[model samples]
Target: MTPLDSSWLAARPLPQPDGDIDKNSRGRVLVAGGSETVPAALRLTGEAAFRAGAGKVQLATVERAALALGLTMPEAATFPLPANDAGELGAAAGSVLAGYLDRCDTLVLGPGMGAEAAATAILSAVIGEPRKGLSLVIDAAALGACADMPNAVRAHEGRVVLTPHPGEMAQLMQRDKSRPEDDPEALACEAAERFGATVLLKGAQTWIACPNQPVLRFAGGGPGLATGGSGDVLAGIIGGLLSRGTPPRTAAAWGVWLHGEAGRRCAEQIGQLGFLGRELLPHIPRLMASQR
Candidate 1:
């Protein structure tokens, strides 16, 4: 496994804006559904996207969470879609989402979403139908939806990136709990090839793999990254970079490194164990700015 470090960043530097460009010209990101109860997950993601250089950020969530998110994050435009009694996004919202698909450069699916039956239907509809110019970052409860069909995300055909922890990865592969594919490098590569999407298997040491490319390993987040919702931030950061027009593989790799750096910095400031996932938000652009 190769380390993702400054040398790697130097070798494959991030893209820089050329000339006069408006915020719209830079990038626009759409975050689709997290749990109605904890829209913070999706909110964290959209904020991270903005920090990662996305010019515009939008959120499409359930009715209740929709209003809260709009009030909390004024920078993003929020849409409230139909929700079930359990407060999860419903299948009926698919048509509403289709109308916004063309407007975003990248889509972040499944953050705080609880694995409700409706979630699977929504995921199936969205992931089953891939968009030509859109990039997808699939994480959290959405991974459960992927578990139902081994090849459903394959429809994305290299345009999607799946960020899953070990448990979720097992579900995606339908592997036994023993986790025969627990080795980050092998699991990341295998998932990428089998699902036809870039894979970032999150762990103490994260690994990213894309088809036909060597595995990229990043090893430096402290225990701080162990906190809940961190994966949401990671997904958002990666999605944001993708929205900025970074290629899938590059965006995943860069996102992993930037995420780790942000975690380490946050840990250093607040002590290793007490930092919140939202704490990582403020450090993201600072880390990304230094990298660029």
Candidate 2:
């Protein structure tokens, strides 16, 4: 396949600032993921959502992480799920989650959720159901959870966006191969067509592809973003955009752009080596404001 060209970049338009009174019209976003090992994922995603313009951000996590997240970011609401002896979300947690799915405009799954069986079950339930009005963004562990559940993506009634690194894409494609560093765009487009959803394949040049839309490459982000938790931050931004009534392709395209811009801003200040995901939080609003 020929490498995806750069022409798709011009297709997306920057978001216009809402009138002062209409600013509150921004949507609600729910971030579900967090386990004993990686409790910070939920907080990272929730904060990023708020920064990206979600009017409200809620997080669903295991009991232990809930207290810390709630205390740390009092702006975000928390829903604690029942965990088994292993400290993982149990299958019953899905029933609890289903009740809140209706309240959120978008659902962002699998930030820091570990690979425990109970967590897998909860993710499976969330993806299996038909979420009619909600948009879903599957990232990190959630992408891995769906490796054998390609049909789950097909069955979902809502808009779905998948953000994965090359390794994760390999697993999703069920292929034991490495990403052709030469053409990340082509690989992402193939995966998006196969999965029937918008695909954001992350790398030096993040590439986004949707079933009907042309492949888009965002070349703005820098190496500063290669750190951990950055992907969760990107996922949260996408969730926020989806909540704001942006189409899946538009949200993915803009989210990737904003994320890279944020990383670039951070690199300018922190010299690229020590910039943390949390640091990128403050830059989101500035970046969005610049779009105007």
Candidate 3:
């Protein structure tokens, strides 16, 4: 296994945008799915994408939350998706989001989105679209759908990445949640091969497994990163990297390092624990710049 550390990152650095590059050239990330229950999910995600150097971001969520989310985060263009009476984005949201696939470089799905069926429907719709060059970073409730729709994910081939903690991993593999994962790397590799996508199995020491490649482990980021909304930030960072034209495996590896290192920095300045996930945002750009 390769250790994803500062030295490893320095040797294989991220691509730098040209000085004359425009926002469109840097790429656009469409972050879909949020709910009133987790109002900060989309904001934390969208802002982290910008911090990671995505040129633009668009937030698409249920209509009830769109205007307020837009007002709070003016940097992103917000789209009000169709919502059910219960306020969750439903299956119909798929068609609306499908229309935007052509223009999006990466789609970050299932951040704070509480409805599994809705996310699955949207994922199916998005995958069914015939667009090319768009990648995906699937997280949270969406991971369950991904497990059910392996064929849909394979349709995207190498352009997909799944970020799941142990619990989500259990759901993806249909393993008993109460049973301990004796070998996390084995489980990650199994999932990666089964889904034909890069799997970033999150933990104190993250294991990133891509089909046909050796597992890469990132052992930093500290326990502080276990805070709520932290996974959303990591998803956005990977989305931003993919939007910038980095391949899925590389993006997952680099994003894990960036997220972990930012958490480490947060621990130093704000203490090892109790640092909010939002506090990790500002550190991303500084960390990326230092890499250059």
Candidate 4:
């Protein structure tokens, strides 16, 4: 396993900023996941995408929460999608989102999405269609959706990244979640090969695996990053990097480092465990810049 640290990150440089470029040049990120129960999930993801230097970020969520989510985040362009009485997105969401996919450089799927039929439907609609320029960051409920659609995920090949915790990873790999993972890196690699995509298996020590490549590991960030919405931030960071046209494996690796370091910094500033996920955002750009 390769160590995912500052030295490794420095060697794999990110796209440098161009003074003459506009927002469109940096890249656009579309975050499509949210419900009434977890409406603010999109805010954390979208804002983190922006913090990671994505020029533009948009939020597509259930109709009920769109207006208020928009009010909280004026930076994102919001789209209200059809949803059920419980505020989960409806099947039509994926179809509606298809219209917006081409406009975004990357799509961050499934954050704060609760268990619902819409999750599978949306995943099917999005993966069923081919959007060449659009990369995917699959997380949360969408990770579960991926299990039922492995071939669909493989259809995207190298353009997709899966961000799942051990429980979610177990689901994707069809492992018994009740049992402990014997080897996290091995499991991550198996999932990566199975799905034909980069897999970041999140834990206290994160592991990133890509098909036919060396696995990378990061054991920093401490318990502070174990909080809610933390994975959403990491997913957004990866999505933002993918928007900048970084390769799936490279983006996943860099994002893990940035996220861990940001968590470390937040722990230093706001105590090790109480720091909010949003608190990790401001440190991203600075971390990237420091890598330069």
lDDT of 3 by residue, 1-292 (tens): 9888778778777878888999988989999988767756899999999999899999999888899999989999999888766677788999998888777899998898885337778888888753568899999988988878887787787789999999999999888874326789989998998889999999988999999999999989999999998999999999999999988998999899999999999999989999999999999999988887
lDDT of 4 at 11: 82
List ranges where model 3 is wrong by over 4 Å. Answer: 115-117, 178-180
Assess the local accuracy of residue 140 in candidate 4 as a C-alpha lDDT between 0 and 100: 93
lDDT of 2: 0.79
lDDT of 4 by residue, 1-292 (tens): 9999888888889887778998988999999999988998999999989988899999999989999999999999999989986789988888998888888999999998988738888988888975788899999988888897888898886799999898898888878994326789888888888889999999888999999999999999899889999998999999999999888899999999999999999988889889999999999999988988
Candidate structures ordered by lDDT, highest first: 4, 3, 1, 2
Candidate number of the best lDDT = 4
lDDT of 1 by residue, 1-292 (tens): 6788878877777777668987877888999886667776778888889888898999998887888888999999999878888888888876777678888989888887886727677777676677888889988878867776657777777889989888888888888755724466887788888888898888888888888988888888877889888888888899889988888989998898888888888878889888888888888877777866
The better candidate by lDDT, 2 or 3, is 3
Task: Quote each prediction's TM-score.
Answer: 0.95, 0.90, 0.97, 0.97
Better of 2 and 3 by TM-score: 3
Residue 178 lDDT in candidate 4: 48
Q: List model 2 lDDT by residue over 102-194, tens digit each.
A: 889899987887667365677677877787778899987678766677677867632889998888887777766566365677778877777
Candidate 4 residue 120 Cα shift, in angstroms, is 0.9
Clashing pairs in 4: none
Models, CA RMSD each: 1.6, 2.8, 1.3, 1.1
Better of 1 and 3 by TM-score: 3
